[model samples]
Target: MKEHFKVTQRMKRGVRIAGLALAFTVCGAMAWPGGTSRLIRKADQAFELEDYKAALKLYASAVEAEPSSPEANYKLGITYVQLNMPKEARAALQRAIDLDAKVEQKLLLPLAEANHLEHNFSAAKAYYEQEKRSAPTLEKTYQELLRKRIAECQAGEDLMRLPAIYNVSNVGSAINSEYSDYVPVLMPDDKAMLFTTRRPDKGRKSLDANGAEQIRITRMQQGNWQESELFLETQQQMPQHAVVSVAPHGKELYTFFADKGLHVSYKLQSGDWTQPELLKAPFNQGSREPSLFVTDDGKFAFFSSDRTGGYGGLDLYVSYKKEDGSWSEALNLGPEVNTPYDEDAPFVDTATNTLYFSSRGHNTMGGYDIFRSSISNATWSKARNLGYPVNSAADDLYFTLSSDRSTAYISSDRPGGAGEKDIYRILFH
Candidate 1:
């Protein structure tokens, strides 16, 4: 797993870290209390970050500092669960309830999971059901997943299972195929989508039996995707061959030409694509597969390149489009975003003020998983993996989000895909 590798990497660098198998909790931004706040913050951080042992040690000091801190006590209980010490976990959870009865039901969901893992199904089911009823929109999926867990307990399934349930489903046949379909770019209205696929070929590419390239456009009328149909011949000259990336606005598309050139073709206002133009300067120099993302402001372009001078590997560089519309010489994102290891799949989510990408340099739980960091401030922090189900041992990269910021689509080579790679959606709660 990428995470296991990361822990090993950190340890070799003299950072003592515990591997907490890809467990994640949805969190909201909270205010920093500041100062020796460091001790408690570190403890709370270790707990939230899935490092139970360190969290346990730090929480002890946190409790001593503020004996009446209900939050600290509640976190202590959660850390116990992570450490897989049931008796201690139970006692701490009960102590939390005694100190803050409000957590009795709210935090009980995690408590139930701990109990369930410890073979206390009755308690888990009771708590899980109680928590399930607490949220309306979440009830259905929670109930289903709970049923699966409860069944696993009844059947005596192994506690440590392989290829953890991806909890995945296709975006529907509307977006899938018997042929390879990938690199989806959902337009702002979420109504139109332009994706590249290799189907019903012009009969070229490689002689891999499935050789050919094409483009398909689908309109979202009402609420669902209308039937996907191929593009007109005017836009098909280049055959939409090897679409590596697309800008957020769907106004431009980038691809690798069979002639050993990279083209940045413009989509015209009348729904026609103009003659493909050869990209110069910053882009044309990169390797065959180019990464692209047009930032919201429209002038800055973020992409990956292995141009002559880079920190190392395939570094991500940002180019500023001049007033004359020519892109300036690419500037490396520096070693901060780039690494000795290859980093690709550049995506900008300014809604969260973050840049999401994939890297092998950072501690990973598996092969090439998505990691994101805030760009709102001057200095960007280390990137955090989006974590399991959405990411696995298989390569997971190239993501696009709906403009409203509620849903996202990520490309992966994980099994069950229509082909080598398929796009999966993540609807956040």
Candidate 2:
């Protein structure tokens, strides 16, 4: 009787344990897959919202859970590309293609871009050609863009083989940071530089929260650039400024403030910038203008805007200062200078009557390339690409000349630098 009781009790205990084990197994199977699906959905949503950092983490988790998932790997690669991490993007994209060859057709162009951005021109060209061959029936516009991309790769390869003799070097950590630093405008005699930086705001704990770009000025002391300081007069409790140009004499600073249009702040007697006031009428026509240059005499202002009646995108516009000290109606720089694509960052060399800016439409190898046009007796000439190493497969914009015109500063993302967009000084021999 005792043995019988012990056997029955042991069997009951075993049954209870098995039931608990079965419950856990069933619950885990449902929760694990469902949780992974939820993560993937959230990641896709974040990516569409342009929350790349958030998407990166969530997609990484999805990839971890399902290493063989081609979709997850491909999406992660796209995120990396958007974040400007081309190496990681290339690897992830290649893995996705390996897992599913079908992804190759869908991913070839972005893969090409990744390679191009990393300065792997040969690989980029090959991928672009492959994409071309695979999609022979693509729209004519897209086909043309692809051909431009291929040409860009060829240009990059050519440039790499025989680079210009110009000695390019980082401006040092004093004027540069791990973050981007570009759009540099050097004053006469190289006395000072007012440029845009994504450096953290000194007073803010979370720099990304109100992360409007801050304008910083670096003074040249004893022939070296000193530590940069923010344009405090432009700073609010929440700073906002995108300085596009500084006058040749550095007495006037022009900024593209949101909605309020171009605001000019002149140097005050106290050695500080006066409160920025929006330029009147034609200049403040409630259009998107990203850059401008005011001649030293302040007689004419060359600006970039996408207002109606433009050829397309952002066309260059020039507004002449009237005798009454007011501005005239904005006049498009016209087809000779503007194209059916964007033309921005206009810098006028008043001494030479030359206009130098960046254009995407006029014979661009791939992306925006710096172009120069001579303004002869009030008529603009045909724009010409600055060419080769001065321009790259990546964007090469914001070209500015020093006082003597012996040296030029251009903003570019060409490889082998600190990172995204560093300013390069071209010393003309």
Best by lDDT: 2
What is the Cα-based lDDT of residue 350 in candidate 1?
A: 68
lDDT of each: 0.62, 0.72
Best by TM-score: 2
Over 1-429, each residue of candidate 1 has an lDDT whose tens digit, in order, gives 454455434323211122122112321122222333567768766665554657789987787787666566566666665544556667767876777676565565556656654556567667757665764554243444444444434332222233334355556678777566777777667887777676756544543334456667788887777778875445465534555555646677666555456677777889776776778776776364356677756777788776667765667878889999888987777666777656787888766778888765554433456778776456666776666566643457777778887678787655556755567777766
Candidate 2 Cα RMSD after full superposition onto the native fold (Å): 15.2
Runs in model 2 deviating more than 4 A are: 1-42, 57-67, 119-126, 132-141, 154-163, 202-210, 237-239
RMSD of 1: 19.3
Q: Give the C-alpha lDDT of model 2.
A: 0.72
